[model samples]
Target: MMFKDWLKNKTTQLFFVLWLHISLLNLFFVNKRGIVFLWQNNSELNTLLTHFVTALTATLFYIAIIKIRLRLAEKKLTLGNNVFVFGSAVMLALIGFFLF
Candidate 1:
């Protein structure tokens, strides 16, 4: 396939996987951590906002790394996309654990 087509497919797949991860995370973890957005005190709002921001930031970071990996692979650079994906996931998990 062409380079542009390959890149588009990779990006779409990455986004789908990322969405699945985020959905599962919210379903299993967010409620347990009391991150629901409800009319409550300032502290609750702050906590909810913090969790939301962290998830957003982590997703963005993952996308950036994936884009870089795609570009490098297109250029025939010696880098493994799986390695970056796994590393990013581990780092994000650690950050989430620490935050919560």
Candidate 2:
């Protein structure tokens, strides 16, 4: 398979795993310490908005990392498997933010 095809498949699989794991984490640990939700008072709209903004920012950062990874991959600068690894890490971080 071509490198682009391999990257596409790997990215899809990473996304699936990331979504599944993050969903599970949210279901099991959303209110746990150090999570943003733990500090939020859900009754207020402004507080909810703040949390939304925070989560959005985190997700954007994750996307930026993914973009950088793709650029590195395009340039053949990253080592074997490191691109997927870094992408997965970013997804996990976004998941944490989502859970919060």
Score residue 57 of candidate 1 by CA lDDT. Answer: 70
Put down candidate 2 lDDT per residue, 1-100, tens digits, no spaces.
6977986676656555654554444433334464454333444577555545655554565667778878988998866688679978998998899799
lDDT score of model 1?
0.66
> How accurate locally is residue 40 in candidate 1, as Cα lDDT from 0 to 100?
45
Residue-level lDDT tens digits of model 1 in 31-90: 566766433442365655655565667567767877887898899988578986998899
- Candidate number with greatest lDDT: 1
Off by over 4 Å in 2: 1-40, 79-100
* TM-scores of the models, in the order given: 0.42, 0.40
lDDT of each structure? Answer: 0.66, 0.62
